[model samples]
Target: MATTPLRVYGGVTGSDRQAERRALFIESGLELLGSPDGEAALTVRGVCRQAGLANRYFYESFTDRDELATAVYDHVVNEIATTALDAVAVVQEPERKVRTGLARIVRLIADDPRRGRLLFSPFLSGTPLVHRRTESTRLFTQLLGTQARQVYGMQGSTRLELLSGFLVGGLAQTLTTWLDGELDATEPEVVEWCAEIFLATSEFPQQPGRTSIHVPDGSEP
Candidate 1:
């Protein structure tokens, strides 16, 4: 069967226009969700106004505000993760890789306080956003664990997973406080501390005592 050519209006195809609208809505979502107003700017009307689109266009891409917010959140998370992964992939030394990856995260958020607020701010902790954050944390936990194992030439173990969770969760909370202006430290300083934590946590304990930290894969959590 032959495919029909796309219908164009004012020199743009119907699909092109639709994708443009979706991108606009996502951008508006980022701006609003990260603004000082936080999730308060998540109303359909507010988002529509910010995007300069009719209310109908919002439904074209997202079912509601939460869907739009999820898209916005996913966009930020994917970009950060991809950038960090790429940064680490290029470096040969593990410490350099860790520092380089972490520096990208710190710089990205520091350069845009809006992203920092959108990500780790207490004000943005609505139930849906919280759920999404939890899911994203699990993803990062897996990524961190995999990278640590590869870098250190270690096999998967329960202890490595535990340390990864602790480091990822701890760093997120630290960034939250830092973004909230409670840390009283510079962005580089925060990156340094976090890199140290990552490096130290990546170190494996060789000895097994009566109450050792390392549990075999089948052990209880």
Candidate 2:
């Protein structure tokens, strides 16, 4: 009779387990931070409870509640950026591209209003998330500048950067207002208005003679 060898079940490795725990913490943070109750619900213990994770697991992945909050904020912003870019990439017409991208943003917020509140709510002011919001705006401004160059042949200029920042700031405020019930417009209307603003900015004349108006150094006109 031959002796059969016993098989060992080597389950998940330590690294794999840690990754799982980190992901759980991130998702839990998102829920707590994005809740209608807002950042008040985002304590470390609260997140661990939400994730059904031990406090030790939370510390293993994040230094503190602020770090986890930042991670959650970045996750949501990344999703918004990717979804908008992917929607625009498939279109050739400039108008359609703008419309598609803006519509995706509006629809995403509509689908999950929690994300809108998390990203844009004034209630998050003075929180670590305020820095994250500024970072997100900077990232979107860069994206807008790139899109202007690619779709409109508009080169980098001081004016273009200023306009990009202005548009990004305006858009953030508009969406925030809509999310907070301060704006009465429906989702489609909001999308259309944003697309119009974006297209108008993109169509600005870039002729050197026209746009190169002289300005005194370090002086505002």
Give the Cα lDDT of each candidate.
Answer: 0.87, 0.86
Whose lDDT is greatest here?
A: 1
Regions of candidate 1 where Cα sits further than 4 Å from its true position: 1-6, 211-221
Question: Pairs clashing in candidate 1?
Answer: none
Candidate 2 residue lDDT tens string, 63-150: 9888988888888999999999999999999899889988988889888887888888777774678888989999999998898889
TM-score of each: 0.87, 0.85
Lowest summed lDDT over 10 consecutive residues: which window, candidate 2?
A: 3-12
How far residue 203's Cα lies from its native spot in candidate 2, in Å, is: 2.3
Q: Candidate 1's C-alpha lDDT?
A: 0.87
